[model samples]
Target: MKITNVEFVISAVRPDQYPVDALPEFALAGRSNVGKSSLINRMINRKGLARTSAQPGKTQQLNYYRVNDQVYLVDFPGYGYAKVSKVQRQQFGQMIETFLNDREPLRMVLLIIDIRHEPSKDDILMYDWLKHYEIPVCVVTTKADKIPRSKWDKHVKMIKTSLGFHPADRHVLFSSETGLGRDELWALINTTIEEAKAEAAEAHEAEEAEETAEVSLEK
Candidate 1:
């Protein structure tokens, strides 16, 4: 799919109101101020496509962006904000859990983390929660422009080991400023959508077979 067009659609808080189209969705997730919005803007080659700010916790809702009129790029609120009250944080946690568990249309999550620092506690928890839910994820290390090229491997390995990522999961280095890892991320997104669709089709076929067997037994 050619990414000829991209536009912001809405910021939704509830799953009942999410877009009902059959288009595949890739959601961007990360801690507060991890440059998640900036990365989305860079990938789509549009400035301000996703509003960016130095302030953490700016994106409070699930922001949806349609690309080429075929796929969606969802931006989720950031986690691990120190300033947010405990009750608000708990509410946010529940909101995210509901979304991840219920949004079957979501194909994969592009989990963004800063490359300069070690994975925080919230990061680890997020990783584990996704794995538990069986939602496919690709961890993207943002702000690569700040790190030296020679030290990239060392940092990547550190993040990988800390998160206990499996052999199949992918980890990519990204930079919103210099446009690094853009193509790689897009390719992963496309593959993820295809894999999810294939699995769904297989499940549908199996259900049909089971229904046919029941019909034969009735006759």
Candidate 2:
């Protein structure tokens, strides 16, 4: 994908506020301060399109970033922030759950996790939840630059083991600082988009054929 137009679409808290264009959407999920913003910035080749904050729990809604008008990167509010109010956390949970469960255009979730440490309980739970719902997910272990290159495999293994990582889902080791995994991630996203389009076309053709058969029977 060439580096081209990018737009900050909207910060949506409810389904009604979501974009109506029906572009394929990829949700970014992780704990607060887990480098979701930085990953987005690196992926888009933008210095600061997605705002990064030192403060935890700063993002409270679904932030939509339209890339080349081909897809939307939906940024979910970071979970497991202790400082955030319990009620607020519940609200965030409900918001995310509703979107994930009902959103038709959502393609896959890029679940970000810091590669320097073991996957947290929250991380494990989130992964499990996504799997339970049969939602497509790509676990993105971010901040790979912080870890030494020689021990990358060791850390990745630990994270995978701790999460009981599913074989079918993707696990990408990413470094926002070094641009590691950027091309690979983009390739995965593009492939998914194309697959979705193909599936939709097939479904449309099937429906048209069924309609034609019904019309012939009536005639």
Candidate 3:
């Protein structure tokens, strides 16, 4: 996907602040300083569209970025950081839970993790929560270039094992610094978006058929 028009739209903390355009939204979720911002920059081919911060957990809201006016890449606040207050953490958690549970435009979520380490407890829990919601997910392990090419499989295996990776879930090894797996991630996002649209269309058609049948019976 050649991205041309990518722009930071809004930083929304409340549900009412979310974009009304209803574009398919792909969310990025991960622990603090796990390079979620860098992954977004690399994916969009922009240097600073998603700000990389030295202070983890600086993002306290759902940041929405519009791509080609076709979809929105939502950069969620990084979780599991210690610097934030308990109240702040709780607020972030509630915001994220609400969006994931109720948002209609959300198409897929990309759970980012570090390639060099085993998936953290938070990572595992996040993955489980998404699965429980039956939301489509694509696990993205970033900083892949830090690891040796020969050992990539071993690290990926460890992550999968620790997370109890479901067969239906997708996983991709990524390197934000080197643009690795960027194209593949985009492809997955596009495919997920199309599939969601198709499902919605089919449901609409079914409803229409039922309504028509009822109308004929009444007549």
Candidate 4:
């Protein structure tokens, strides 16, 4: 995707406040301080559009960023922050679950993980939950620049093994500092959006056909 117009749309805590444009949305989920903000900046070729905070669990709502007026990058509240209160964590969980289960425009989720560490228990749980729900997901390993190129494959393998990564899901090794996986991630996003559009179209055709059949029988 070419670099173009991007805007910070909203920080929404409720479904009623979400963007109504119905653009294809790719949600980003990760542990606190996992370089998700940096990844978003790198993806859109911006320096600080998605604000990076030194504090963990700073993002408490779904942050919406509209890209090229064509699609959305929805940033979920960072999970697995030990410092966050139990009530807050539970609230975040409910908010995320609702969106994942009911949001119609969601195309895919980019589950961000730090490449330097093994997948956390929270990471494994989130991945499994997405799998159980049959939601499309792409595992994005961030901060790749911290690891030597030689060790990249080994670390990736370890992470995948820990998470029991799905065979059909995509994984992108990313370095927000170097823009290593930006293009590949965008390609995956574009492909997913197209697939969703096709599915919707097919469903619409099937619905119309059924309606027409009922009309004919009534006549």
Each candidate's TM vs. the true structure?
A: 0.92, 0.98, 0.97, 0.97
In the range 25-106, model 2's lDDT, one tens digit per residue, is: 9999999999999999999999999999999999999999999989999899999899999999999999999999999999
**RMSD in Å for model 3:** 0.9
lDDT of 4 by residue, 18-38 (tens): 999999999999999998899
**TM-score for candidate 1:** 0.92
Cα deviation at 119, candidate 3, in Å, is 1.1
Expressed as tens digits, the lDDT of each residue in 1-219 for candidate 3 is 999899999999999999999899999999999999999999999999899999999988899999998999999999999989999999999999999999999988999999899999999999999999998899999999998999999999999999999998899889998999999998998898888889999999999999999999999
Instruction: Name the top lDDT candidate.
Output: 4
Off by over 4 Å in 2: none
Screening candidate 3 with a backbone cut-off below 3 angstroms (N, C-alpha, C), the clashing residue pairs are none
Candidate 1: list runs displaced more than 4 Å. 209-219
Against the true structure, candidate 3 reaches a TM-score of: 0.97
Tell me the lDDT of model 1 at 22.
Answer: 70
Stretches of candidate 3 above 4 Å error?
none
